[model samples]
Target: MLPIFLKTLPFFAIIALGWFAARIRFFPPVATEWLTKFVFYFALSAMLFRFSAALDLTSLWDPAFVMAYLGGSLTVWLIGMAVARARGLSLPEMAMEAHCCVIGNTGFLGVPMLVVLLGPQAVGPVLMVLIVDLLVFSTLITLIISGSGRGPIGWRTVAPLLKGLVGNPMIISMAAGLVWAWLRLPLPDPLVEFLDLLGAAATPGALFAIGASLVARSASRIGPAIWLSFAKLTLHPLAVGIAAFGIFGVQPFAAGVMVAAAALPVAGNVYILAQHFNVAMQRVSTTILISTAASIVTIPFVIHWITGGLP
Candidate 1:
């Protein structure tokens, strides 16, 4: 466990460094935003595309794995909604809290970190998890919020969701890479080198950006934040683990990766959605801050349990 914790430390340390820099004003908010944009559009996309390009489409598509992850995540999402409703939150606020429960930081944090710790085999399952969260659950929340007080769901309400998904750089990069893989296209030597160079920035830059972004988040809503963090860092993984291993019988290694991905903190994107919709923004922001900090310890423990300390 200590070894696993040590291995994961540098990643979180980079995040902490970013947080510290922003906290001290050495890295301002505008700089953080630009850095996040760079990672989202360029460095991270290059890494995801390169990774997806190398994967066999068959390996990336697993109905069992998808079912297991979605089942587990949806279970947690429903639980979050129930709790929020018990607390008397509005429909949008309940949706936002439920969103925080299931959406892990797979793109920025899980993709880079899991591939490094768990190996290249981790990429396929991690991508599957990302797809489920981005496509299924994200769309679910958008639909719930859009249809809430806007009266009747129509193309007008649904069009923005389609546009957001279509224009998403992560989805675009992954799909394009999969297409390139389907055709068995060979990447040129020069192109490979360019991608490698740019992609290398993804890990550190993403970690730093996450840390810097947290500086702007105030931990004002401690009680709800703690509950959401618990749901994310603990209940999410437990539910996913059961669905993967016990119910669906996903492959052991893929199931392990799925559980680890589920264990990630509330994604930074969750806060983006909350802020955009102006629903439970403080709770979502504080949840991200708390969960990310807590994951520094929880994540390593999870990896150690799943991997049996082999690495």
Candidate 2:
């Protein structure tokens, strides 16, 4: 027990330490944005390319994984949105808050962690999670946040969704990799070796980027942020666990991944968008930090509890 706990400690430390550095402005502010874009656009793209290359399209065609993930994500989305509305949040705030709660830090945190803890076997489930994130969760976010202008589903907002999804770095990466995998193409030793070097940087780079961005947000709105963090930590995972076990009867490693995802902190992208639009930045940042810290404990226990033993 002590050994397992100690091993998991570094994962938590990376995020917490990174958050502390971001608070102090360790990286130059100007450099941070560029670095973020580099991660979002470039690093993420390459990371997805690597992830996509790992699996055949036939693995992607698994309807069960898709449905289970969507069911879990949508269930949380609706519940979180309703809670935001009940709290008397305006349309924009509600949309932003709901998105923050639903979308986990899947790319920055989920992918690398899955690869390390679950090994190459994690590729399939991780791919499924990524697909659900892009196609289901993000698309749903856009659709909810975009208000109808004089009619239903305005084209102006719709364009961003199309652009974002179509032009998305990860999605594009996945598509390319999917083609390569389907064709069963082999890369030269040099390229494979090169990709290995690039792949190694994904986790640390993303966690650092997340840390740099976490602080310097709406620091005043700590109240709402704490509430949301509480929800994200406690409520979201409970919802996923219930459905995964009760409805789908998901067991073993798949159940572990689903529950781990549910236990994830608020996604950094929400913070980026919130800050971009001048929405609830402080609260969102707070939620990200608090929930992430909490998950350090919650994740291990949940993994142990749900798996019927330590996995």
Candidate 3:
């Protein structure tokens, strides 16, 4: 237990630094966006790229666990969407809220954090979730929210799907990294070292951006945003846990990843989707910020209790 906190503290500490910077208005709202963009497209992606480079496919392709994990997330998204519709929200807003609930911050947060807690091997399972998070879950959310097909599959519909793919730097990084790793091509020393330099900046840079984003005003309602946060940090992990152990019989390392998946704060892409589609960006953005800050504490406690003593 002590070790868990010891390891988790540094991760959260960097985020705290970011939160402090945000509070100080170091560069104002616009600068926050720039910082976040830098972290997303360059720093964070470089680390993930390296993580994937070291992944061994045989271990990562656990069909039973991957299918169950992906399947569970899909179910959660469906139910969440249904509920959002029942609330009579607009499709774009529904996408925003629903995405907040279902998608966790698996990329920027998930990769580096898992690397710290579970070592290089953890990259394997995180990779599995990243695939589903980017390729499948993101696509599904955009298809539903951006277009209704009530009249026709206009450019409106196609555009959202394309945007879901290309606009997300994390997803693009994952795809490119996977292809390179699969091909087993050697990365030149200078290039790998350059990536390493960028990779090293990933964790702290992302945490800071998340903190800064939280400080800026996003147009979101208090009630809905709080509810979204509660759902993401608490209930989402429970759903994943139950399914992993009860339905899939996921054990040990694989099951640990289910916890990580469940524990991720919220996908950074949620805000982008929200902004593009005119959803509650303030609420969405803040929820991501707050939940991510909260997760620094929440994740370790959950793992300490549920990890079944994985020293």
lDDT of each: 0.95, 0.71, 0.75
Model 3 residue 85 lDDT?
A: 83
Best by TM-score: 1
TM, every model = 0.98, 0.89, 0.88
- Summarize candidate 3's per-residue lDDT along 1-311 as a digit string, tens digits: 78788888887787777767878876577877887778888998887777676666656677777767776766666666677788898776766777788788777678788777776767777778877777777777667765654566678677768865787777777767777888987788998999999988888877777666666645357677677777777777777777777788876677777777778888777877777766677878778866776787788887676555454
Tens-place lDDT per residue, model 1, 1-311, is 89999999999999999999999999999999999999999999999999989899977799999999999999999999999999998999999999999999999999999999999989899999998998999999999998998899999989999999999999999999989999999999999999999999999999999999999999898999999999999999999999999999998999999999999999999988988888998999999999999999899999999889233
What CA RMSD would you report for each candidate?
1.1, 2.4, 2.5
TM-score of structure candidate 1: 0.98
**Which candidate leads in lDDT?**
1
Candidate 3, which segments miss by more than 4 Å at Cα?
154-156, 217-220
Off by over 4 Å in 2: 23-25, 148-150, 306-311
Model 1: CA > 4 A from native: 309-311
Candidate 2 RMSD to the real structure: 2.4
Give the Å shift of residue 166 in candidate 2.
Answer: 1.9
